[model samples]
Target: MTRSTLPIWRRIEFTVLLAALTVGGGIWGFVELLEVARDKTAHSFDTRILLAFRTPGDPSDPIGPGWVEEAMRDLTALGSTAILLFIVVTVLLYLLLDGKRRAALFILLAVAGGQVLSSFLKLGVERPRPDLVSHMAEVYTLSFPSGHAMLSAVTYLTLGSLMAHILQRRTLKIYVLSVAVIATLLVGISRVYLGVHWPTDVLAGWCAGTAWAMLCWLIAHGLQSSRARPLD
Candidate 1:
């Protein structure tokens, strides 16, 4: 059936299923990419780019802190913290406003599920963070897909979509979604700029997270519609 003709519940279910498959396929593709990245030639290319951005520059020197590098490092840290706080507060606000236990549970699951997926991807890739410069912030995990980039995408975009659903003003809904997209983009850029994650890592994070967020939103919307429907 055409989309307009489909029942709301069916449409939601289809969207959610599509999202899940998208994310699952992306994750599988990412894993294959990681395998390719493990090759010596690929590793060299990745390392070369990361080393190029290192701080404290001397053309001959491998390591030194430049002003630009320092600034980028600080920016990344700031962006990371800000996004974290925003997600926490937004989830709490949703819980308070919705007063539906299921809504809160879905939000929690989406965020937590994203985090877990990030962790697993990091381990699977086992790529080390850049060591060319003194790191501005301490980090100990393998850094294939940046956690900050992924989580920011999941939390911010998911909330934005939900807000768009509930809010009456279309402009306001667009504004909310714009902010979410902007935040997610900046966070991913910050990871690359700080020399902590490879550009590809950030890109993969953005892709994976976006897919996951869409999936969660579709599921949540379906649940909400089911609840709203009158008994047959």
Candidate 2:
């Protein structure tokens, strides 16, 4: 069918499929790179690069061990509460302002679904964390995909996208999105810097989380559009 004649749901499905393919391909490429890094010669090259940028557990800088420790403590302290608050506030805002309850539902589904997927992937992969340094926090789960990274991407990016739709100024919207993206990146990096996760773990988390978030957005948008359209 022609573009104009094609159904909206079908277009949305096509877009979602394309997004899945792109994310899957990127993840596969990253896995291949990790495999290459496992080789002795290739491993040495990777190790040198990592060492060049390594911050040797200094307690001085804001991004150093002391800061990371405090941040992790704060994150753990506010973890469940923050998630609950995020859900409650988003739902209330959507209901009161735009009556877009679907947006709030989408955010919950995306983040929760991503969490489940990340957990399953981590268990299946069963990758262990690096033992090169002392971990700042204790963790017993598999380390292939960082939960913090996945949740950060899902929560921050989803909220940022929703905010973008509501906000008027293009620059303000872009700034919000940029901050979300940067925060997601920094949180993921913090896990690695704290010696709690492998670099590959964070990368995989970001890819999977982003893909799931986009999928949820596509679904929510498609539903909203359908509701707006007149009956056949």
User: Best-fitting candidate, measured by TM-score?
Assistant: 1
The sequence of per-residue lDDT tens digits that candidate 2 reaches over residues 8-52 is 766655655765675676567546645643443424443443343
For model 2, the stretches where C-alpha displacement exceeds 4 angstroms are 1-98, 166-168, 227-232
lDDT of 1 by residue, 140-219 (tens): 67777777777778778777776665667989989998998888887777676566676667767777788787777666
**TM-score of model 2 (CA atoms):** 0.69
Q: Model 1, residue 157: what's the lDDT?
A: 79
Provide the global lDDT of candidate 2 against the true structure: 0.61
